[model samples]
Target: MASPTRPGPAVAILLARGGSKGIPGKNLKPVGGLSLVARSVVAARQARSVAAIYVSTDDARIAAEAERYGARVIDRPAAIADDTATSESGWLHALGLIRADHPAVSRLVLLQCTSPFTTGADIDGCLAAMEDRQAACAVTVIEDHSFLWTSGPDGFGKGINHDEAGQRQRRQDLPPTWRESGAIYCVRVADFERVGRRFCGPVALYPVAHPPVEIDTPLDLRLCDMIARSGEDQTTGVADARLRPLKALVMDFDGVHTDDTASVDENGIESVTVSRSDGMGLELLKKSGRFRLLILSKERNPVVSRRAEKLGLECLQAREDKLAVLDEWLSGNGLSWEEVLYVGNDINDAGPMQRAGLGACPRDAHPSVVPLAGWVVPVDGGKGVLRAIADRLLALA
Candidate 1:
């Protein structure tokens, strides 16, 4: 039975392995510009109820990546890491290792990397549901309204959730069914250990708003990427949450402002074209007075300064270490990284982009930076990057 008072904060255990027949190295595969395993860690870290995060993996690369994202790695045995091993085996092994060190951990959370859209809020909701309902387990689920069928032994298709011979019922007439999202699962550690199963007792279902997006094949990966790029309300509520506290908007100059191209005359005069629409968008944001804007450029060209001056935005030029500059600016302006949105289109911007509250990139940005971006604009660099982002953030306000 769930105790009204929780014994302690939950610990999240993520299982990521190396081999995948459907998509090779699936765990490391990037969905929405972040690796599946890394995204899971990010979501776990964001959960206020999660006290510790662990990754159970046999692959060295997965282990390293899990650690890179601030999760402790549990060296899963080669036997259990193979395809034949059930997920329960991995969780039990990881839980034993976790309990050895953190004896006070009573709540156990299992996060799946395949569910790319899982958010910290979802995890917390599941944990809260388990506690509030006094249930032994809670899992994320989504409302399902669909007609199901099954091939009966009589060699005829029969309705599974409804009567085929009876009066046809509207989809809305059917009682709602809860389908597991396979995102977050919270359970009492003792119950799981004793029963050797996730659903050891009464289970609570915590419904999430986002549609289920699980990455198992290449097509799923592509679809997730598109959803992430579109930044839809259904799937991007977590990302939009990051933008809610936005106090500053920092942008990289070259690709973001100039299409990463320049025209040179015989006189060595270089010129670049910018979108007037983007200019208007930035101007509107400036007028709104909600954000402090700055253009950070690796180029020392006077054009960078002139453009910033024209826009009446702060300028930081020729900074190889853009994150260091960003840190100083945040500290000086009394802001945190979680309250800033940084946009970049190249390798140099990757570090700061990942460190910012929401890292965004253009559609045509370099392959390296694309995966590192949290949001990708539909348009290419300099074509309306600022305008697209401006519209989204302003709408949120």
Candidate 2:
């Protein structure tokens, strides 16, 4: 019998250290309502080719946030997590660990938390470029059309892209130049190991349409936040299509159904308040018979099941790995992720939200969760959030 070839690996690696001289806790800083670490992980998860995502971080908080966004955490050594260490150190260490656990890993997609605007399409582009060109590495870049100038020792500006003594030429006449985006890099594992660097053997450039946005200081963070908000405002028309799909609707009970707050008496009994309007909305959705509704909760409290019972909806409670359970449920129910809409309000719900076709959240959802949501209902959690979302989905119907 002929030997079978191993499948090419689809893995992504990210490096995030705790120390940041320019901006303390930089990896955890929110830009677009999501921490940089979470944003990168979500991007990796979005890529159709990516099967495993690993984050190398020494910081406990960064590791927790990365995991919340669907990434495995690699405990980076103190030696490689410091400011002085090059990024290659952390990536090489992570590669070793990832390969040990997943021996089939053949290539790695490296992502940077500083590049908050990086998306799954960018990663996929690099991967495709590498494969199509048979290159060892591929990187994201943007076309640079701006004229370049440099000050000489004689205190005179000199043109670097064109002849200063000859007649001026149109910008379009000049040869195209590409500037590295510093957002995504795809490299063959063997080539990276041999060269001890990202760029090895033949390199390919995957040009991206978006401007290069790198976060290095506080001002950059603020600017990126503004850009994100502007994008959200302009993307409503596209976001509406996410609601048009029908098959299943999954929700987190505590925050999506309640106010994310509860009271406990001296006797140890806990009580929570929910909106009757939300119940009516759920009833209407049930009557439609076009959607499968589920309450997926991490809380072990009995009230979760009680509420689901009253609403006449199926409920799964105390799920530590909501995404895993949700996947199993989807497989059993014969539905695809693209056909379902997920609603959540906190860190724990991030992974499932990113995995679903459409993610919806209450206005007051955690900052990290907000960026993952396709729709942010006007109402806060437990404040008729369900009613508001149901109205929007039904309007499309």
- Name the top lDDT candidate: 1
> How many residue pairs clash (N, CA or C atoms closer than 3 angstroms) in each of the candidate models, in the order given?
1, 0
Please, what is the whole-model Cα lDDT of each candidate in the order they appear? 0.84, 0.82
**Per-residue lDDT over 228-341 for candidate 2, one digit per residue giving the tens place of the 0 to 100 score:** 656432112123444667589898988889999999999998999999999999899889887899999897888887899999999998889998898899999999889888
The residue pairs in collision within model 2 are none
Worst lDDT run of 10 residues, candidate 2, spans 231-240
Per-residue lDDT over 167-259 for candidate 1, one digit per residue giving the tens place of the 0 to 100 score:
999999987898899888899988998899899999999999765667878998888888776656323224556678888999998899879
What local lDDT score does residue 372 receive in model 1, on the 0 to 100 scale? 63
- Residue-pair clash count for candidate 1: 1
Q: Give the C-alpha miss distance for residue 326 in model 2, angstroms.
A: 13
lDDT, candidate 1, equals 0.84
